[model samples]
Target: MVEPVDPLQRLPFGARGPLLDHLSRLRHDLGKYVSLQVRWLGASPPPEALRQAMMADLLETHRGPGGGIDAPTVWAGLRPALVGEVPLDDTITVDLSGDVDFERLDDAMARISGVVRDLRGGVDGPQTVATGIEAARTVSDACRALWSRLRGG
Candidate 1:
């Protein structure tokens, strides 16, 4: 049962840059819309605009001094010697002590997951056929620019 070892895997995580940022490589399915012929329906249509927010951008924008994606994920695989029977707000308390905002923390995490899900599968935004075609080109150009600390025009 011998197998070859991946040289990339042997390197520390930091040594691997965007090589492991699979997030970017995920599938992006672009949805499309078009006008219908002889559609004189008088009902007000639902708002065509979609609220597209980049969750990671908000996380990294450091108007404050220190910034990082602090979540329970970092405390994962924690093996405490004991599990308490105590309950905090109906949640089973663990032997390990941490933040009291467990409820809100979970919600925050779900939001990040949702944004990632949408980005991977959902279309970026609404566009006509011609615009959608143009979007494919513009998107490729934008993605190539890596975010940096420098602020400029």
Candidate 2:
């Protein structure tokens, strides 16, 4: 078994609490983001194929075989590290095992953040859409610790 790295060791010190706290919150809020995303996809009644594709991607990306380091996985990792209890069965199962690359997840998260920011910036969108995007951003922000710790930034 690959030994888990001590996330705190990566930090410079003094920032551990805030960083860990952020990751913990991110893990908590990720659920809200998923719920909002699902609701937004359904609200417009978009084409069945498109919706299915999106959800399929989400499932594969977040819970499928290879830990893609999406919000959920990142969130899951933090709890066990912090509480000293490894999660044997996630709320959603992951089929592959390995260290997650934070960079890719970081980029994907940035894109999502941008979209959410636009909604909040008054980009002339429907209230529902704006609300959903805002919710997603709010949830994503909760993971700042997860990102920082993972990225060793």
Which residue pairs clash within candidate 2? Answer: 26-142
The candidate scoring highest on lDDT is 2
Q: Candidate 1, 139: how far from true, in Å?
A: 28
Residue 53's lDDT in candidate 1: 17
* lDDT by residue (tens digit), candidate 2, 1-153: 977754345443354555445455555545344444455565556555434433333333255465433443444544453333442233311111222433333444454444444534654245434443444444454344445555464
Q: Which stretches of candidate 2 lie over 4 Å from their true place?
A: 1-8, 34-101, 113-153
lDDT of 1: 0.26
Shift of residue 5 alpha carbon in model 1, Å: 48
Location of the lowest summed lDDT over 10 successive residues in candidate 2: 90-99
